[model samples]
Target: MTDMASAHLSHDPKWTRAHSIFSAPSEGADVALIGIPAHEVSLSATSAHQTPGAIRDALARYSTYSSAHDVDLRDFSLCDLGDVDSPDHESGEKKVATAVANVRANHKLLIALGGDNSITYSVAAGMWPDLSKIGLITLDAHHDLRDGVSNGSPVWRLIQAGLSGKNIVQIGISDFANSREYSQRAKDAGIHVVTRDVLRKRPMADVMAEALDIAGAGGREIYVDLDVDVCDRAVVPACPASVPGGISADELRQAAFLAGADARVRAIDITEIDATLDTPDQRTVRLAALLVLEGACGVASRKN
Candidate 1:
């Protein structure tokens, strides 16, 4: 009989581990992962800078295969470029931009792991210096149009930086999560918003298609901001602004996959999760890991 200790060491050929897929950058890769730990300027208190490592750890809990997409991420080359040092300050943002610029041309897709929602501004700026050439899609509970420099102001800052309001599409904006003033700000910017109620009524596929159409209009590359707070509070306790009536975990995963599958989607960021604030089970970080896999699945689908 096989001893218990020996059995624990046995490898299963059918089940490839997820974490094994990512390695140090070599040549160009199919996907590039970068950590932007930007919690210093978060509006709500957050330890989000610790999230990128937490998400990487959680990837060990998953596998490289996705039954939903009928693809294995192992088929693609993935690399982790490590974290941007001190990305929460002005100089750090400059580093974020430089890092993104340096790597964007080398990978098929770039996935930026957030320190906070604030990373959205730096990452997007890094992806496209001329913001007018790229469209924006944000999945979040807030309008993120608040004034000043913080997690809540990335969208507004991007618009001010030259991203056209008409080219932006925000999904899952929740009721009571944002103020009337910010709602007006979103409107005045001409940003298309698909509220949480609309998500409940429309199929995710349809919503995603519409978002991509608008944001990717005029052949613009797209950048997706997947703020976990758009999910139900129960689904993402680590997300400071999550509400009870937000979208489900599955819905957010679907959106991530859909965004990744599109060729126009050049970059994506997962944000607003304070790993230190997660539940005992670490469900939030686990979900964030799955979101990364889902996006990778979408990238794999593009080859088909």
Candidate 2:
């Protein structure tokens, strides 16, 4: 990972724009962004820990293509705190918790670049210390309300950790093949399920506002977790349990826009990028990179 990260222009004269916001708190700089490369996990996206490096590479090209980020990552205060080196999956929960705790402690909004959905559990565990009430806004094709580990089933574990089901506002549940029991568990627990049908019917803007209201119910620590599979397979690819009719990039971006606009949202994660399913040239990392930029810009705009 170090080798790949070194290959990128994390620090280059022309890329000074990206570095302007990439300041470090260790340097006494108030960094608004903390890129956590959490790659050790049980799901496909967890492998994305290694992908942020690729995203950096892609960002260099993208920023050069557009004069926007070249103007100092859009003039945002950010930093790449680097990845959490966790090798074992069984111990992943602990490692991610530590990494996220550090990010939270730094007072930087965590842009958790993932390896899988499992990392969300660790991120939540870490942020639990500072968060009094938390709301989960999960944008996925499937409702990950399982009770145990079954491929990409970290959301269930997150709920088990006491993240109130009622506080969760699940959007773009384009598919829910789990079971009636699973649906009842989340519903019984008070989790709000905003189906794609409903989302399409209602104003996306109002839906976000309502989601925020639900998420804000506890106290406020909005965790946005996105599994690439949640997106239309056309935009991405197949995952553990694949599905059709996923959310579009624009929809996800709009959601990111909402999350970023909502000051209560403290942490965000864009997970599940299968480079194997990328372009013919293997450039799938752009999706994640663009997602991060959208998330960052959203936060930057909201904070302003």
Clashes of each: 1, 7
Residue lDDT tens for model 1, 58-82: 7877889988778988988899988
Q: Which stretches of candidate 2 lie over 4 Å from their true place?
A: 1-49, 64-74, 87-90, 130-132, 238-242, 281-284
lDDT of all predictions, in order shown?
Answer: 0.90, 0.63
Model 1: residue 35 alpha-carbon error in angstroms: 0.6
Best by lDDT: 1
TM-score of 2: 0.81
lDDT of 2 by residue, 1-304 (tens): 2355346445555554342345444532233444445544454443455565666555543452223323224455566666667623657556666655665556546777666666666677677863336888887766777656633566777777677777888887764655788777778878898877786677767888898888887567688886666667666652434356766767776777577657778778776664444665443466666666666666656545
Error of 1 at 133 (Å): 0.8
Candidate 2 local accuracy as lDDT? 0.63
Residue-level error in angstroms, candidate 1, position 46? 1.1
